[model samples]
Target: MTYTALNKQVQSPLTEQDKRIIATIIQRHADEIKTLWIDCGITVWVQLQDGGRLAFDRNWFAQRVAEEKTSLEAQENLHRQNQRLEAELKQACTEYGLQHGEIDYLMFSTKVYRGRDLVGFVGFHRFSQMWTYSRRATEPDRYARSASDALAKLGVRQLTMV
Candidate 1:
């Protein structure tokens, strides 16, 4: 595997110490995390002003669907369905990647301001099974509260309405 892009714009600047701080702060709110994110299938992906982005882990997702699907399929059709599901997952991830940073495609897009400066953006979307992709740009604020709370934890102090 190639290990290029050290200090390049494409490189992730997160350090081991930074990761530990984030992990520790998050563990303190396990219940809220479960309710706001895990139980609801919510995602609050961030893209920084410097062009760095943190997106959903597609490889992990594909592996997760593979494990969950075996239990949902009959013995004879399991392999076939698994193959189809894997392909569908890949396609779905590709489409999400394409639309992720675009404001027009977002159900809710918020500017993350740390103090007075524009530091990054937190884009929220409801993810689901392979077939159910986002269609409505104007989804209800039923999810916005949870997204806002999550962004607050990420150090976003304010949001400029779009």
Candidate 2:
């Protein structure tokens, strides 16, 4: 049945069990609930301090619980992958004798280093939708290429040395 049509069936007020289920779903899927509501045209209302009532679609709540579970699973998988990449990056840095400071800056900050020395800074070029490493325009390409390769192993992509 359509949601609009089902909305008129106020005779069957939500039971205590239904309220419990809804509360559980909301707590478990707080992150995905907003997008789910917009996508499914689900409405939610809450009672104010004075006197009012809250309404929402039970079907939508159920669907959101399922979808949020799937979404959270995917996110967990991605997080695992990222963790693996981070470990690999750490090992690579150790083997290459690269300083941890350089790695940290590359991963977390916009500062760019030239062979263990901070040469310049990097910025995202909005027009090109790519990162621009600014400094040492005449330097050999090998250093930049090596740095890019290291970052690539850490799941960083589309970095421009220029």
Which candidate number would show the highest lDDT if scored against the true structure?
Answer: 2
Q: Mind sharing the TM-score for model 2? A: 0.36
Query: Residues 88-111, candidate 1, lDDT per residue (tens digit)?
Result: 433432432221233322333443
TM-score of each: 0.20, 0.36
Judge candidate 1 against the unseen true structure and give its global Cα lDDT, from 0 to 1.
0.36
- The 10-residue segment with the lowest total lDDT in model 2: 29-38
Q: Residues 67-94, candidate 2, lDDT per residue (tens digit)?
A: 7567767767756654554454455444
Over 4 Å off, model 2: 1-58, 101-116, 119-162
Measured with C-alpha atoms, the lDDT of residue 91 in candidate 2 is 53
Cα RMSD for candidates in order: 23.1, 11.9
